[model samples]
Target: MAPIKNGRLLFNEVPTGYPIPGRTTVYDGSGTIDVESEPLNGSILVKTLVLSVDPYLRGKMRAPEAKSYNPPFALGEPLYSHGVGKVVRSEHANFKPGDYVYGSLLYAEYFVPKDVSYLQVLVRPEPSLPWSVYIGAAGMPGQTAYYGWKAYSKAKAGETVFVSTAAGPVGSMVVQLAKQDGCKVIASAGSDEKVKFAKEIGADVAFNYKTTNTEEVLAKEGPIDIYWDNVGGSTLDAVLGNVAPFARIIICGYISQYNGEEPYGIKNMRQVLTNRVAINGVLVFDHHARYEEEFYKVVPKKLATGEFKYSEDITRGLDKGGEAILEVQKGTNTAKKVIVVAND
Candidate 1:
């Protein structure tokens, strides 16, 4: 294929209840994708390989004042999320041509990053793992799990740890990491198939939350010492009811409430006070200053030792991006759902 001097760009015009015409689209554009690109400043042109489709992106699509980790996605602009891309050109000294990097890039074949500071250079070229793994296990979700567990819960050996959305990118890593730390892990997913995959990855106990009563199933498993909460709403409430004395609950992502008209409320806040439990909300970007410090110390070491593992649900093309997003939100994808924008 010849060089893409100009290519199609996909953007979201408005939030929708489901995937529909006005919600997403592809259009043609031209001109240099410099850091000073109009509405998006500090942009850097990138040849995207894999675009990450995450539940968090849905939250970002809400109206501006919704108060998420970042501001809401601008109307009539390309939607952005964590992705792996090749730097085809660079106006920033930290990034150069031919460098394979991972960061927040637009959901397009190419991107001109506004704030390239979020972008990190990918050092491992001949990766023993697939490139998509970096976006899931070794990338953002991996960091989310690692720091959340270490900082908030401090999960230890022999403790009963329960993880919700346990088959997705962050939850899957949390299970393996907890196991590596000698914790007995109980995981909850949307389906029986994902429940099995959760076990295959290291979960001592896995349940299909869609079919089982989370409280009843967890009751048989005994009290949980640590709760890695990826799905909030009823799941969060259930975990609160079953938490052991002095337990730690790490609130990662509320995938359960992301698409809802109103956020889910927990009727069990009193449990935190009664059980002496520590419930902390985690945003990975808040710990950004220590990203390099933590990444080098934790991720690379475990990856080399074969202690960390990850999985992805790959969608074939940009046209399929909307489908991938829907799949993730509906809890259909077993792992990290990634849209392949450009393979080569």
Candidate 2:
């Protein structure tokens, strides 16, 4: 067979408002790596299987650069995301062809490694397990959920826990963990379908925040003990006013304010002061000590049994990444959004 030519999703423009697919993101260009040639020293050639489209990447798309934890994607550079792939060629000692790996890579169908020292060759999951799980549940999103929820929320059994945006990758996992840990989980999503999906995944009560009055709903749900804060706009304000004393508010994400167009003002600082709620932000890397327990012992067992379920809204082909990201940015994606480059 001939060598495969690869297409790439490039960051074409930085948007002050919401990202426009074809304008801010362009997918017209491609680059081909001749398989006949060699990869760099210790570089591995990988055929992309799954590419993660996370909300955080939208922040990175800006060029002038916000004061962020990660750098902005350079203009004309291919958009990069968390990706899982199979090694097609390797120039390293530890990696070999046919091994599965996951790391940050461009939205290209294949890797042309010049400086990818951060890539890791992963061990294959069970034959029955879907390889795409590495890009979602067993990957960064899940890790973010697991560590973030446990580390900050410190939720106890029989506690009333409320999670906003409960249908997202991290939020959905947070819902299940709170439920399985014996907490009474009350979750909300922007859409009705997302609210239903949250209920299906172990939330005791799930409501469409767009349709339901958030304050009225929480007023009935009573004094939430833990608020796994995902959307940090008016929702955070509502949680702050409605939570119990000493409640823990875990700041995992702020999907509502990502586009930087409509900045929400939080006016309920007095509630936090009176109630003594703890608001803590989480980064998945800060809790790496639990990685072994989660990857090896916990998550696999939960997956093997019927105790856990994860949803992935997989868009096919690398060309669709631009549109998929736009969907993610607008609070429309109901599941973990990943681009399926190839799934064998």
Candidate 3:
């Protein structure tokens, strides 16, 4: 068999602020894969299909010594994210050729993993959906929303819930879940188009933070009982000022500070003590063992039935991986940003 060219996105240089395309990451098409003859050792050879472009990756673009939950990207090596791929060859008992899988995958068209401990064979509840959905809606982001809401947000009926970045994968799912639980949902997004999408997905009051006053809207709507803070910074300050007594605050992410020149300091943090708020930081990785099986069983059916709306802003080709992630870091993406390496 002929050797096939492999395309890869390498973490070139670590960035102080927002990562630059050619400077921080580079495309390397110099490698080739001989599918039939390449040594697999004990790893599976996967053909990357879809990769997620998430803001959390920005924290990973730092010095290796900087302590964090995830390891920093090794300079000159392929970047990785929660991705869906097809197993091309396997030397592991758990994987086999033609099996669809989901896990932390490299930013390459083809590669053999050094570790397969975290990989799982994808068994979709609704097999008709696109494989990219597994990386976005029914994958990490959705899992984050489900686990956080169920674990930290003890939202009751008639409570007011505010979700920032409501058009995003996590926030959007939060909006839908809150609405289903009989809460009055208020959602904020960066654009008017996103605001409309939030309303379409069941937000009772959707506002564009860029155009409208967040505090004003929350005041007019009601004191928020549950706040899903995705974009932190000014939004957190605003929500702090507007929360109801004993409000539950889920700190899933702080995307606004991920690439900002200076970190945002909350000015209304005193509201936390005043309202007796319960602030809980939820990391999806922590709850995966407890909730992932249920998430797969539940979310996919709602998504397939059109009862739950999930959107993906896709960029085709592995070469565009750098640009795709930059879109997510800048909050310029309308929905979940996903890079498609190949069609399944």
Winning candidate number (lDDT): 3
lDDT of 1 by residue, 1-344 (tens): 33443344455554555434335544444533432232323445688888778878777766786675567877667777888899776767888888988888776676677678778888763367667777777777888887787778777789999999888888988898899889999999998888988988899889898788899977889598999888778888888888799999888887766665476788988988999999899988777576647665678557656767666788876666666777887887867887777774
Model 3 — TM-score against the truth? Answer: 0.98
Query: Lowest-lDDT window of 10 residues in candidate 2?
Result: 292-301
Order of quality (TM-score): 3, 2, 1
User: How does each model score on lDDT?
Assistant: 0.76, 0.82, 0.91
For candidate 3, lDDT tens digit of each residue in 1-344? 99999999999998978899988999998899998888999899999999999889998898899899978999999999999999999999999999998999999999899999768999888987888888888999999999999999998999999999999999999999999999999999998888889999999999998889888998899798999998788889888988899999999999888874588889999988999999999999999889988999899999999999998899998888889989888878889999999988
Highest TM-score scorer: 3
Per candidate, the number of residue pairs that clash is 4, 0, 0
Off by over 4 Å in 3: none
How do the residues 219-280 of candidate 2 rate in per-residue lDDT, one tens digit apiece?
99968999888779898888888889998899988878888758888998788879898889
Poorest 10 consecutive residues by lDDT, candidate 3: 256-265
Give Cα distance to truth, residue 112, candidate 1, Å.
2.8
TM-score of 1: 0.88
Q: Quick one: ranking by lDDT, best first?
A: 3, 2, 1
